[model samples]
Target: MSTDSVLRFITAGSVDDGKSTLIGRLLFDSQSLLADQVAALYHGKHKRTADGVPDFAQLTDGLAAEREQGITIDVAYRYFATPARKFIIADTPGHEQYTRNMVTGASTADAAIILIDATRLDYSEHTPALLPQTRRHSAILKLLGTAHIIVAVNKLDLLDYSEEKFNAIKRAYSKLASALDLHHISYVPISALNGDNIVTASAHMLWYQGQPLLRLLENLPVANRNSQLLSAPALFPVQRVARLDGSSADDFRGYQGRLEQGSLCVGDSIRIEPAGQNSTITAIYTPAGQVEQAQAGSVLTIVLADDIDISRGDSIVAADSTLQPTRNISASVCWFDSKPLNATRRYWLKHTTQTVYTRIRQVDYLLDVQSLNHRQDSDSLQLNDIGRIQLSVQKPIVATTYQANPATGAFILIDEATNHTVAAGMITSLV
Candidate 1:
């Protein structure tokens, strides 16, 4: 059964687990790469790996430093298509320093292909040892709401392409997956460097009766985009003010933004949050034509009946919605900066489109990545640390819990002095 759905997925694992090589192999075997991309492998800088083939890892590890260091430092995204499906792959960095990059890549992914190097594990027994990053990334993927998880047992060639070894690794990961409550978990055995069990069934691994990697992706069901959005309250974050024909004679003003959640219709009453101004939708504008109704994910211009003082960073939400506007936020934050998070220091908090001054009122606890438990003794958090923290904002923000509405419940902490993103946060509870 062929499915033409587009799947957005991320490949994550510990450093040198072959995340980039897997992507390169997928592109190469699928005939997805252009002629020059393949030809360049024969020339400049792109040297072959030990297998005497063009370095497939070079396809996704595009940064100069990454190439020089033989690592992936940033999130390198690549797109390819088979007749049955189209795919967007985010090959994220596996280094501890770039954990934030992995978080960013998995945040929007529908599924995650987490690679495990067979060479590193003692797979003679049923429960093989797992790398720390494997468990950590699995937890992060679950936290980010990735719907599907595929534990790809990579580099089986190193293990003599043994089915028993693959089964042992699968059994080991299953225990961890069950602990994390990850429902849609599957496992596949393949060597990305040798192109076995990737595009087609492997002759070396005849015992693996499951479909190839490409086939599994081709038939994987993608969750409907509209269903989740429609279940949440309508959210419209004003991007910019649109004035038609630059004319004030008619006082024409339209607010433009992508409808982030739910559906909106003409004559529907809505409230502009933080200001609490109420108005009725006078009209909706789209490139095709004017419409009386618009669904989530649509980018449209909305005209309100009453003249309201709305600007960029303002949220227009359903009038009867229960989303609370608050200055106190308690969230699970992943600290991204080299400097530890200081309770006495203030930051630039950005949520949706609103930016305001904020500070850590309290650090509730820090998470132990290995055990996935909370430790309350920490006074501050360092780089790549995930913790529960309370934030006091200078202005009230209209937000919902991330479990309820992801679009309105997420935010980022930025350093004002250097203007770098320091933390990524998801609202757990608000006061």
Candidate 2:
């Protein structure tokens, strides 16, 4: 069976909001946790309890500090399977200090579970408790742009399983989502610790008529977010060059990489970037042998008509029509460094199958998370801040807009000084 059926989702929310317990319940109800693992939760040394019952959250808070503090300090990953689908879950920390870890975990997620404390909203005021003083707003601002979110309003039982309380937080967050133009969002009221409305319908929540969390996750339609991008240009970034054998097929030279966009068929014309040399796909070689065509996510070594020089870091793109290779450019960036992003600071810019030295051109502006307003002429961007800026580069690299194509449009900035990935960027309108 193809692993594509497995959905990769991550849990993220504010501190003391029950992310770990939610994960534990998912594991337990799905019957994915091992017998020993569940037993250890009840009797382990790290168990957190005043009574004899196991603190279910201990299933994820295995760290000494996390157990001592009764909170998650870092990203916790787990895997589980059901007959319908498999899941790779990353329960990300919600503390202000670990916002970067949250971003890292959510970056590749197929779905984002935004855990909201059901009782945290003021129903009269119709607003949430915004942490203006901390990085929570900053973190939410970054995720707003890219995530397909599930607003899981957890701890509903704490509010007496009141649907009104659930709706209050849901309405408040929906306002924020609307202001950010996010529409494909769903709300589920769940008590993660009790497994109520998590894997099964809550006997107490008679007000709800929707599927439980697990059913929703399993039945949610899986579609590539960038399916439309394939209709336009095709981009194949060469990952490596391969030789079949010691002496056999010595004449065979193939360029290997996963197809990034569009489709590639044998006899279709293509080209290598920066070099801009033209060629045709003589053959598309997969472990399944040469097929007539290939699409996005195809991992194959392609044989070209020309023996012209090619290597890793070189891209195979559609010939005749091509994408521009740029170095001096403007981009929308979400700042992830604790130290403010400076125009003078330098970093390594990683694009599709390539990396180059780069620096910021200008710190143009930052965004207001709650209102979606621009802080134009802003002074600096601290960790978790979302901003737009022009970047100067040491060499050219291929890219697309976050709208046109996300996979190739996204990139990370690695700090040259410490090797930490300090920023994420999406091409807005290339300059």
Candidate 3:
């Protein structure tokens, strides 16, 4: 909960749920915007407010098409810092067709703020139905392993700041979260358009006692991946091999890559994956110079004690690590291409630094985003479709389960014909 720590989060919800406005409000109210940006907001041709207040959503809807359509079509990233913490916010499109974009934004996020439009739900009902996009986004967040979730009930000002209405919507969403098995979630009632309960407490709603959205976000704990993986076995995928002239007596041979997991120190025994060659770490080098130890997420070069045939696409893991390379894998995939997934077509599966030709062996089942159930009738995955599939690679590649280590577990399917990314997949198990 250190104030200096950086927090990466995304804003998501159904269309017109105030995703952009909430971000604008946060920036404007927190005084994060500059004088020139503030000037442009007041004079921008798209400004549509009647009371002379700048249209807050314009701050993020920067695309011409987005401004014209008044809808977020792509992932818009904004950076700002408060005295409490630094934040990187991704304002993702809420439209169902742009689900892939949302996935891209939420992939690396530590937390997600799902804005629920208060006016869209029925306050009178005991269990008001939630929006389909709401369910879809929430399910996707869970699938992507976003640890924190804040369900911000927005547009409450339109409903006279009704506490009863907020409670009803909260109850409905709580049930959905329970069904999805999403545990780390918080509830906040907000009015993004009116700037109520965004950065400061709202005088209109006194019944609630929880901290405002900004305060909650500032205090939310961010996962320290490097520290968390310190005890785990190191997994480094070589991206490059640097070697000096053969004539040089001090032959400099180093394998350069980012440490995906665990820690590596001088004298640590390491194994080359797929090759099964054992070597000891003789030296580690960063941009600054040589270092004795390198932690996870560090981009450095490692010189092994033994001369091994290591190259790009090869993994360097701890000698004692239990990871095994496999040619076949069962995974959950989110289809991103307009073309339907074809099992007969060969694809280029890009995992870490390795790219291998692969073919889909079978389609396990398509996940129904709304019901969170598996549909066995579908033979192919369509655009934005989520399905479990079995695939075989041309060669063996080392990987862990997505739940265990996302760095090695995640991969993308590239359509070899067009070279367009067709799918993003998470390895479930080795087949």
Candidates, ranked, lDDT: 3, 1, 2
Q: What is the lDDT of residue 150 in candidate 2?
A: 79
Query: What are the per-residue Cα lDDT tens digits for candidate 2 across 184-259?
Result: 6788889987789899999989898988998878866556654655676778888889776647756778899888
lDDT of all predictions, in order shown? 0.87, 0.77, 0.91
Q: Which residue pairs overlap in candidate 3's backbone? A: none
Give lDDT tens digits, candidate 3, residues 1-431. 34468999999989999999899999999999999888866777777666567788889998988987899999999999998899999999999889989999999999999999989876567989899889888988888899899999999998999999999998999999998899889999999988889999999999989999999999999878667767777899999999987679989899999998888999999899899999999999999899999988899999988888988999999899987789999998999899999988999999999899999999999988777788999879999888899999998998887877888899999999999999999999996
Residues 133-203 of candidate 1: C-alpha lDDT, one tens digit per residue: 88878878766778888888999998899888888888888988887778888788999988898999999
Instruction: Give the winner by TM-score.
Output: 3
The TM-score values for the models, in the order shown, are 0.94, 0.88, 0.95
- The all-Cα superposition gives candidate 3 an RMSD in Å to the true structure of 1.7
Could you say which candidate leads in lDDT?
3
User: What lDDT is reached at residue 428 by model 3?
Assistant: 92
